[model samples]
Target chain A: MIPNNISKLIDAIINKTEAKKAIWGKTSRNEEFKLFLEKGAVTTDTWVENGIEAIDFAIYNSYGDKIDNFVAYKGDDDFDILSRLHNTAKREFFKVDETIENLFKELNDPKSVGKRQIEDDTPLPF
Target chain B: MKKTISISIIGVVGIILCIYFFEDSDKTLPNYATVIGTICSIVGLSIAYINILALKEESIIISKQIHLTLEKVNQLNSLSEISKAIKVNQEIQEFLRNEKIELARLRTLDLKYMLLHFNNDLLLNELTSDEEYKKLILDFGIDLNSLNETLINSKRKVDFTKVVKNLEELSTYLTKFELKLKSIKI
Candidate 1:
């Protein structure tokens, strides 16, 4: 049986991952996603790949060799194990999505946009 | 003093020539005297015209020098403003490192305005060409956006080592840019 603490941690990770995935699905089409990729130095494909790799690494570091046993043990359903693992990867991938979205909003604020326009329009006296 | 002396000499010479031409016993100016007076007047007028032209040329040179100096001053001013913005950004980074989220957020807003002003100053002074300016804007925007992300993530207990590294890279780039601006010769 999975220990209660480990099970709890996995649940938390899965929940966070699902939340992030939903947000990413909504935002991946926006212009800010491109900006995020540029600043974060990851293309869309690499970002997803990296996210999965990070989740795997985190799981390994946290569980060590026991992760295999946790997966193989019949105490947990095979489908449940796979679903949890998938959600964990998604959570890792979407970790910074909200942060990037907030940043884009701050930058694209109307006040800032208007200020830039005014500056561009003003003529130099010289 | 030299111009006054020359004018005085010319005036005395004119008076003497007038006297010489008019002192004929018949009290009439001779043809040769009239011709000499006309020649002298022509020569004096030509000299005056040449002097005026030289003065005009000197004024133009002075104006151009003034213009060049002003442009250099503007360049330096824009660079200093950029330096100030960089310093503020450094402070924001420090605030982030210290876990001062609210302070960093407030300062980030200030830095945004400063960056805007810096961009305008750069454009006004023509420090960077349009293409170069666009590239610079992209670079800075990326850095600032990353900084913003770091600030936001800090609230959620996210590891910020990567953001800090990116900020350091930006700081290095900005320092190099500052040096490049300083090296520009008018």
Candidate 2:
């Protein structure tokens, strides 16, 4: 069965992609990547959401595609696939060690991080 | 994985109780008379109140865990986005360099051997040499040094991966936490 969190992740990807036009403005490159990723052999939901094609491809290949991409895009096989996987195992962690360090800077900056206001209906994975 | 499953179980129980309480508020009770009925009523009310309290606690716990997880996921997503943006631009550069290299390789060959070399598949050492073909092979070797750089910066930016791990740790710390978040009773 699809785990609820995983299901929610998948849903969020689709929903976000559907709304990207309003979030990030138009880009021809984004459209090009979108087309390649939509049909590519990989888990493309997130890439489709973020309007980033190569990421979609990388993610697809990383999860386990034959990975017949180019020399350029393939992740550095630092210590073979296992090492890479292990290294990436904690790739998503955000420790936030210095919450106070940059709050003032962020407040002053015009280009603040645009926090994605996740939908109220979207169930979070804990 | 284990922690999440537990929270889900607990959450399901709480939800079921809520639903039942709402739906059967005035349902008929099995007959018991006088003092016995009164005693049972008091006990039952206390039990109900305790259950309500439990449900509320579970709900609060589930909410906190969910928020933590979401925050982490968002952080990781943002870092990945930045990494990807760098990669996309880097790939374009690699594509250009690959084209230059291929052109130089072909240029060095005598015109007489041009078609022959083309047929020999040296230009296509990877694939056929066309504008389209070049685009396909020219990945910008961004993984070499770029990914490390991304990881470092993204770490500073708060990689969501840590949050995912932390959530997994906390949720699994107790069976109750998992049961509640996961909505799985057992």
Candidate 3:
């Protein structure tokens, strides 16, 4: 079973994609944003104080540019990694939602072995 | 049968005793108690009969569910096996297509790694001694380990649907891949 947070993030992405018909439409041509996405996560700092953990993460672009940084008062849960990633993609890419939807569709596709089919298996187009 | 015979004997004896005693004795028979007992017995037997029939129906449904689940498991097993084969095939295809390595060197590296990974000793021995294998290795002039590393590091986007389709097709060919394990047998 997918964790609740991850599932919610996927749902958010799917909703966004369905709202926008195209996957990476022409309007979202932000090169800096694309580079930031490609760079992924850069650095993470974690510490526990008074039985409460605090965490911070710095994100970067491909060209060594700092795109965004986040801090979680609750440590791990604060990261909200998938949601952050989804939001970032929404800001950066035009039709990233659709791409994400398609990716999830394939990942959850019933034809794949050992994968739980979220929906009924439809015959492939071959 | 024994219960029925015993009940019949008791019933006959009871009727004879009732006739012998009640005929000579005063007062009418205790009709109220006997009527109540008969009604209670009838109600109890009806409930038991209904319960038995319900249980039999329930058991049949559970048995059918078990059979369906077993069939699903078998299909999943076949799909799992075919999925593994498809993954290996896709990885190889991707490596060969994307890597800038020489054809002979790449094939040698692929064969070596595949044999090692799968632990196919018989295939390993045959291929290692084969003239083509030796010729390719010698002609390429590349270390096997490094060549394998190059293939491993080469990255490519894999189409998930394509992989699943390939696996489905491979599963369909299980009969041809091994005679003992026919599709129908699965």
Q: Superpose all Cα atoms of candidate 1 onto the true structure and report the RMSD in Å to 1 decimal.
A: 23.3
DockQ of 1: 0.02
Model 3: per-residue lDDT, tens digit, B1-186?
Answer: 344455556655665565556544443467535644665565556566666777899999999999878866754554454345445545544544554345524444443343233222321343334443332222122123224323454321223333233333433343232332233332
Clashes of 2: 33
**Ranking of models by lDDT:** 1, 3, 2
Q: Please state the Cα-based DockQ of model 3 relative to the true two-chain complex.
A: 0.01
Tell me the lDDT of model 3 at B37: 60
Please report, as a residue range, the 10-residue window in candidate 1 chain A with the lowest summed lDDT.
A57-66
User: Tens-digit lDDT track for model 2 on B69-104?
Assistant: 875665454334334433433333343345332332
Residue-wise C-alpha lDDT for candidate 2, range A13-33, written one tens digit per residue: 445444432121111121112
Clashes of each: 1, 33, 1
Among the numbered candidates, top lDDT falls to 1
- Backbone clash pairs for candidate 3 read A24-A95
Local accuracy by lDDT, each model = 0.50, 0.33, 0.42
TM-score of each model, in listed order: 0.44, 0.22, 0.26
Better of 1 and 2 by TM-score: 1
